[model samples]
Target: MKALVYNAPYDVSIENVPDARIEQPNDALVQITTTNICGSDLHMYEGRTAVERGKILGHENMGIVEETGPGVTRVQPGDRVSVPFNIACGTCRNCLSGWTAFCLRVNPVEGMDGAAYGYANMGPYDGGQAELLRVPHADVNLLELPPGTEHESDFTMLSDIFPTGWHGTELAGQQAGDSVAVFGAGPVGLMAAHSAMLRGASRVFVVDKEADRLALAESIGATPVDFTQGDPVEQILEATGGRGADCGVEAVGYQAHDQSGQEHPELVLDNLVKAVRTTGGIGVVGVYVPEDPEAADEGARHGRVAFDYGTFFTKGQRMGTGQCPVLRYNRGLRDLVIAGRARPSFLVSHELGLDEAPDAYRHFDKRDEGWTKVLLHPGQ
Candidate 1:
């Protein structure tokens, strides 16, 4: 099996690795068909996260199950399934409460309540960016696709970004006819804007400096705000008659920056605080780490951002932040796809074989033009 292995900062290679096998009684072995290179994966690829060398690095995955353990009764061999990025046990306290992202029984390390495949500080499970992947707790973790589901490229997004994007709007308390301002126009941000449109947002504004990404957002009916030209908050306010958007979503996370390429960890948060209307809700779906060794400053390295708490409190705004519970929203979103109501594959800019993953990583990490998203076909 050929897998994308992390070597060091700004380096990854496709190497022949041993095929994954069923290691647990509840496990299933999946022959991967479509896997994605996520923006979150770029954190590891850029050496911002503490991911070690030689580890496989993909989590957004969907494939055909080839074998299942005796305990797996619901899903069988030959079923097409989408694997959530989070690895959770079906019977944990958190799982029972619909918070699968914080499952207590999956991570082997003490004090760590959550786990994910191929993620640093998550667990020992390898990712699905190869010919074979080992899926633990298969029945609970895998979502079987509807029979004859032909949109593999679109269905593949249910594993992570689709649900994550929906979760962002949910966090922001977006309602029908409400206006939403979203920061960042990456895959997740684009999905967030699409979700807002699906949920009936009257107006959606996507802020980003990249021209290609902003164009993609516009194609999806979102108003594009190029921060390179002017202040994003001012643009949103000007468009909204100076009252600000009803809600705002910070999808750029801690790596946020200005048009000049200067890293400002709290830029989005401050922008959201001011861009959202008073007493409105704000959702943060972007990744913000407690420790970023490669941060631009010592304060950011320690996860300290000079946020505008005073303004946030005075505005009476509420916020929701953390990783998305993929399982909670995947089923409903899948149905929307099956009904042809949503097509996330529009964000995919490149589809390459497993051997081309190394180059794809480089281009995506740099946010190169026309490289909005990359999907890898391992079995190709």
Candidate 2:
């Protein structure tokens, strides 16, 4: 099977790997049709996480069930499904309560916080960036696509980014008629802004220094703010009549802002504090973590970065940050996609075969022009 393997920092390639077969009675073997090179994959690609070499690297996946274990009842062979990024056991206490990402029974070998396919924080599961994937707890984790949908590219994103965007909006308590500001104009950030609009935000301001991304944001009905030009906070405040926005979402993660114009997760927090009105809330969906000693910015011991707690405290604002619990919201989001209310596929700028994954990763990781989102069709 051809799979995308992490060779080293800034090095990924499509190599022939061993075939994936069902290893457990609850497992399902899926012939992966589509997958995406996610922002989270960049964490491992950049050597920011402890993702081991030779691991397949992709999480957002959708495909057809080639075979299923005897215990699998929810889906059978020939059924199309979109697997959530988080692998969960539906019968677990956490999963029963709708917290699938925190499932207690999923990653027994890695402790808690298990993930599917290829992922850094995820366990030893092989990702779907290959020709096929073995899905543990298949009955619990796979989402079957509806009968009439044809845009596989769009449905593939529902496996991760769309639901994640919805999670960010839900975390921020997005409501109709409220004005909102979202930092970062990347795929997730743009999706967050789009989600805000779908939830009825009166105004959605998307901030980023990239001209292409800002333009994409505008195409989706958001007011674009380029951080390189001037103070985004002032622009947001002025746009909102000096009271700031009703809510703000930080989507840049650790690739935030700093004095040197480098990666700083704290800048998003500062912008959220300054751009959000008093008592407003903020949702952060960007990836943030300690720097790797060997790859980039290795000096820091603590995962600590700069932040303006005083401003946040003074504004009396509420904030939420973490990984999106996709299982909790994917069902509802699926309905939205089925109803044509959310077109998250709009964020996808390129679609290529799994063989093109190395180049895709390079371009997307470098934040290259027109590389908003790249979906990989594994069998292509």
lDDT of 1 by residue, 158-240 (tens): 99999999999999999999999999999999999999999999999999999999999999999999998999999999999
Top lDDT model: 1
**lDDT tens digits, residue span 267-313, model 2:** 78887888899999888788766544442244332466657888888
Give candidate 1 misplaced runs (Cα > 4 Å): 147-149
Worst 10 residues of 2 by lDDT: 292-301
lDDT of each: 0.93, 0.82
Work out how many backbone clashes candidate 2 has: 2
212 Cα displacement, candidate 1 (Å): 0.7
